[model samples]
Target: MLRSCCFRCFGRRNGDGLLWHMDLKPHASGDFSIAVVQANSSLEDQSQVFTSPSATYVGVYDGHGGPEASRFVNRHLFPYLHKFSKEQGGLSPDVIKKAFNATEEDFTRLVKRSMPVKPQIASVGSCCLVGAISDGELYVANLGDSRAVLGRRGFDGEKSLVAERLSTDHNVSCENVRKEVEALHPDDSHIVVYCRGVWRIKGIIQVSRSIGDVYLKKPEFHRDPVFQQYGNFVPMKRPVLTAEPSIVTRKLIPQDLFLIFASDGLWEHLSDEAAVQIVSKYPRAGIAKRLVAAALQEAAKKREVRYKDIKKIERGIRRHFHDDITVVVIYLDHHKSSSKPNHKQGTAGCITPPVDIFSYNSDEAVENSGDKIFPNEESRSRVAY
Candidate 1:
């Protein structure tokens, strides 16, 4: 049996700007399930939920620059992915790849039209990872560094985290990425200078694959200069840097445990294995909250702040850990119980109404939408007595 929960918590440093949300539901004759967790640096993260008798669609976009790009994908990606899938008549590997590429192009165009004032939103981009699971098949499309790792239960009943690496990191340091960068700066000794050889233009930005940031992709800006001093050397055209992402897919089995979709900040402090160990020990809904708490605690420890004064220690923590942190945990099994059931089913009755479960939305239609149906929301919101 397997059980799951979708829980999230935003640290104080992120202010009210951080947006985190998750949607999970059963699909394909209840043989498969779909879950999506999205987090952003601003409260502008948006998502669309579509439910079909046979499948559920979910996509997450972590926006940068401003919340608009993230919000745009959240609102549009799933619909487009579904359309692409339908056109292909199924969720084949080729369809998934085309959908990702098409979505990226669509997203780029939409953003440009939506925000005519490029400078106001200039340099803003986003890391997007889209996953569609249907009939034991999982299709993933990604841009930027936001990642998805699969966790599985071993023979011993212990969980193991395996990074299937659905997407490639788009930064400039990769051989292909370096070539792209060098194409732009052929005359420069350093191709996108950084702290050490360890950092290149590709690695420095951290997110190798992404949408937007037209400034970085401009040939004139990133291409190396072609020097022809004193008419001694022949002139040549330099190459330009690029930040294109890769698409990946795999067949899933019941043995596949869970997945962690998160930003680099949370991953910075923990490994996939460490994250699995921690979440496997607790219920799924509490995983994200606990992960955030752990990260804050780790940040606090680094600053030597007393537990009692953790609130007052924000400045110190921010100084050492500046990036906004976000985490989304998706458990594969839906039947596993984290604790014993209590007789009291709240003041209402044995059946917990959908409205009572997800109080986040006021609209009844929004609540009943199959995409927002999360069995763990109500139970996870309460503090264990």
Candidate 2:
């Protein structure tokens, strides 16, 4: 039987300025949890949680160039999502897409207003990952390289569990992604290049899809003061980047156990199987924090430092070892839900909540302009665990 529960059981916790956590709560599988750790000089990651008797929403946002873009999305995206859901009378792909479009358009307008004063704003961008569970369905959507992995049981056997990825990564390091960029701009032979063993677009950004980075999406931002640092190229052309998202929808079943939603930072030190293994073997409460701790321990191993020692390192300096990492583990409850396989769900969930998402597999040598790829992370797509 698929266990379901009302979203009201959420609990929240904060770690240092660089770390924060949310313990288990009512979720599609059972209980849900989340955690975030800052490794950047300034926290470039943002996250959100919304739960009710009927639905739950999770987001992880990884900002690059600056925190402005992520903060903006954190403050605005959820409201837009709620608005679209209400207008459409329920959550659907159209509503989710509209929510993303609204957020992208809003951020673009903000850039048009600020770029004259802050040229670098045009360069700021964020990878967004969102997961929404309503009724008996689960919806996962992404822009950039963030990832979502599902853990399930009763597959190989009742006691055996596995990890299944649920999102598409837009990082150019993937040959398919590189081919995609080339196909999108067949005229540009140098659209994607291999540098430092990493693949990048236009020899700069690694992500081909994102919420901001107006400098890439608009020719207007390609010239002068704003994008001067982005380097000069031919004049007048179509966009160099896109904000559209890749989406996946599925019916939640009894075998589905939990999900691990995280930023590229975590992927740097962990694998889908490893992550699912950890989750399957541990307790549900604070599972997200446990994942972060596991990743940090792995990061320390690369530097040959003790995990305790690594935890003592401060933010700005710590970034040398790891990127900003954020994780949310949603433990689905198939045991408590009063609903059956065909039963209707309750009407719950509020429109007000913080929404942020970022996940990637960076174990590969990746190349993106401006941002240096530290040898600590990797990125990937969604697959059924």
- In model 2, which runs have C-alpha deviations exceeding 4 angstroms? 1-17, 27-29, 154-159, 224-236, 339-385
Which tens-of-lDDT digit does each residue in 252-285 have in candidate 2? 8988888888999999899999999999888888
lDDT of 2: 0.74
The per-residue C-alpha lDDT of model 2 at residue 294 equals: 93
Task: List TM-score per model, in order.
Answer: 0.63, 0.82
Residue 238, model 2: Cα distance from true site in angstroms? 2.1
- Global Cα lDDT for candidate 1: 0.47
TM-score of 1: 0.63
Reference-based lDDT, each prediction:
0.47, 0.74
